[model samples]
Target: MAEYSLLIVEDESTLRRLLEYRLGKEYNVRTAENGVEALALLDEEIPDLIISDVMMPKMDGFALQTAVQEREDTKAIPFIFLTAKADEESRKKGQMTGVDDYITKPFDIDRLISRVNRLLERTKIFQTQLDAKIGQDFSQKLTPKTMPVVSGYTTHFYNVPKGHGGGDIFDWTETRPGTYFITIGDVMGKGLQAKFYAFSFFGYIRSTIHTMLGATDSPAALVAGVNQALVNDSTMEETFASLLLLRWEPEHNTITYANAGHCRPILVSERGAEIVTYSDIVLGLTPNSEFKDTSISMKPGSALVVYTDGVSEQVGKSDEMLGEEGIIKVVQNAYGHAEPIDAMVQGILDESKHPEFDDDVLIFWLERLTSMDRQTPRWFSPFRDVAEGS
Candidate 1:
């Protein structure tokens, strides 16, 4: 049986000891003399929930709540204020400060314990659901359960929900060793209808990529075929997408990319980060426009990060963009040596000064192939003719 820990902060010795004694029967309880002491304890280890007196010297409950709310780690911790003040103003202030609940000083022990347990349970459930939703969306890939053996080149995928699910799809497939194809498309509109449109567009793009695997169609012609397909058939009348098609060839250490009204792909290399942009209009809107493809030689230890407009155009806490520069800085600081890929992703989110995302963010990291993996495929038969003759 695991014990749920509870932290109690009260300036009065009698109340602190009494509450700790009663609650300690079921929970592992720790008491603090005041907010300052409680904060110090928090530094040592986080408690499942916090129950604190409203008034105290060297940091009142209000001040403590404000402080905790300012930090991301502490903000979500359930807060309950134990106060003697029954006045409307004090209660209003506590409510405004976003304390989960308030109990008058002469409180009922059973009720307090019950509320605390409930809060913790609800928090766990919400987080569980969030995890489930993310898992369900990215159904195909496991999230880096094993650390990437090679450093630098890795791809990260995310599912960002737009209103009612519009036309946004991003995918990556390894066609051959050291060769990968990345596809991103934004369908026009929001909700289930838009999601339907996006799904169709994605299928078309995926099929086209597969069909053209050994064929020589430039990115523009690929887009033209997709656009013409959508326009030619009335079933996809509502679908229009800003598409980007990119291929990374490990053999030549090069990246061939083309964009159709999509955001530029930023490369984080040994030389630092730089954006690679080329001209191509949005797909599906026009049927016969020519598009050009561009290519770049990849450095051995570089990462090509691509995203939908969501990330590049996101508005941060200060109302400024979590721009390309911000993303680059975050990636560079977190992506040291060969840590686990999930660590790198979480690190970026942790470094994000603000928590809000104005738009969906998708980050893909393409690391260069290490020497070990760049070897020739062992299963290919070079002596098939000789064996047949014999």
Candidate 2:
């Protein structure tokens, strides 16, 4: 259950302390001298509900209500007007301002508490519904499991939400012929906390990628920018994210990539499979952190397998983890026969064992085509063609 937070806005000192004492037992309470102080507090954090005096210096209850209702963030916060006046006109005016209830002064403490409880209960229900709707929308945004044509490469991926519903997100774009950008990240937290961070940072990265198109060839710089963006968000103090960024250049026949505390990607070819060991600090954990790039020359028919911990840490029938070494073994066994991109994934999952995943799972397979297989166009919309298949 969410612990309710109540902001009491009253200019009078005596009643403010009394309300705090009475309400603090059942809810977290904050006190403000007037509407002006309340607005200042709101800039820091919004409360679940508000109780405000009708008459006050600087800003009155009606004025505060009007201001709160004008904002998208504060509009739905349950509000109650505390007034000494009981005139019908005043009550009607309070209702017009979107006040949830009006409590007349010299009010019975018990009745006031009852009204507060009911409003809080209703607000909680409304918030849960809103969260569910928004979560569904976020799921849609993260739904792409595969991308389309990227010159001489094919891509495939999978996303499986955990029981608590975390998001393991990935995206890629070929900004120009022979140049490509790809990114994958696992968001911290679970359920609503995970959804909030997942949606928030997804937008950040999406916009950042667009802004970064053809501007620089450094994947490390983009990862550093994403890290700085997370550090700038005050709410991300306890949250951290792990991500990987990749940029492919056909002229050099090489891929430049960086990892920010994410699981390493495995490279598989006729020579065998090996994990790329590049590493850096996780995003949102360190301010002004540095991430270095690792470049690899691709052999024809080479395959790259990238996945979140949900696959690496998955428990098998015997409760053993399918760790990085296990992933290496799986790739080695299938390296010769594996297709560059398949709905089954660039790699196989059941070979890793299809155990019940305890967290969200994401796996991406990227393959550089051999000369014999390079028949497709230079580029196409990966999202429009392949995302629906997965």
Candidate 3:
């Protein structure tokens, strides 16, 4: 019994009043005298559906529909036309103008209500399917954003899209008891197109992990397998991906990981922080690339900040980029913070100075916050505070 908002845009007061009276009981309805009034109402608050008269002063129904279609924000809203003529030409024109439903003059109240319900239900179903497609099962999709909870770790992910799409992929899923596979990758260049490359990469990771259930589930092997698959993919010949793959074993309290031409992740713990790096070429660009594995003990009260170049290479006002050292400073400055991950990112952004980011930024982590029992050496306490007291 959710109350959906409906907008009625008719110049005639009688019909408008009738619709308000009829639909008001079941829906949160608003009335507009003409297309201009409808546009004004749209500016104030977007209704779920728009019901507009075909003929009105200032702006006609066609003009209003065209304007709505032009504006990015309002273009997708479901629209209906209320016309006096029930001719075939008018119906065809309404369809051409992308009208979702139509109601002719002398229409029955029941017919109008039924059409309204059908359109709203159809739109709801479409939206549900779209959401599901964006984040379907067996995957942690990162289109809009993704934050997942896995036992034994505190996790957070932040993604700032550069445009319609820039190539940044992040996925993490538990494989078996106390084991997980996480990946963060950036496809070369920006502006999302095929997206097939990124999509294929995720598929390969999951399949490779499952295939290696009893054999190998290490980061190096998984990344190497992905590289081979990408090399075999003809569609990705013109592009390459820089990826960091990680495998966490909670039982062993260890992380075995590898990099494919990606920035090293910061391992922050009681010993302060150290960069975990490995030598490997960018995936797909080179043939027969071998990525070596590096394993690190998951210290009690430790966190790992895994990210792409967008974060580590954030440009500042001085034209100096906040590189690896700068990120480390941000982390140090964010120490003892209630939300250390967010504080650390804000510190980095503050250092960058610009109100907008030039590239999509992602700051991700797998963490266990600090405890008094595990304290770093007093000498290692202060290295750099990128944005302290800001």
Per-residue lDDT for 55-124 in model 1, tens only?
9999999988898898888888899999999888989999999999999868788898889889988976
lDDT (Cα) of model 1: 0.71
**Can you rank all candidates by TM-score, best first?**
2, 3, 1
Reference-based TM-score, model 3 = 0.57
Candidate 3 colliding pairs: none
Please list all clashing residue pairs in model 2, or write none if there are none.
148-382
Cα lDDT tens digits, model 3, 195-218, are 445666666666876786678777
Best candidate, lDDT? 2
What are the Cα lDDT values of the candidates?
Answer: 0.71, 0.80, 0.77
- Backbone clash total for model 2 is 1
What is the Cα root-mean-square deviation between model 3 and the actual structure? 15.2
Model 2, CA-based lDDT: 0.80
Point out where model 3 deviates above 4 Å. 1-140, 143-152, 194-196, 369-390
Q: For model 3, what is the error of residue 76's alpha carbon versus the real structure, in angstroms, after optimal superposition?
A: 19
**Model 2 lDDT per residue over 1-390, tens place:** 569899999999999999999999899999999889999999988999999999999998888999999999999898989998889998999988878889999888789889999998887777777766776667667757447666677666667664356766777777777787878888877776787787778887777777865586688988888888788878766668888988877667788999999989999888889999879988898798999999988889888888888777776556688788877877677565544333333344454455345667777887777886765553465765687658
State TM-scores per candidate: 0.52, 0.60, 0.57
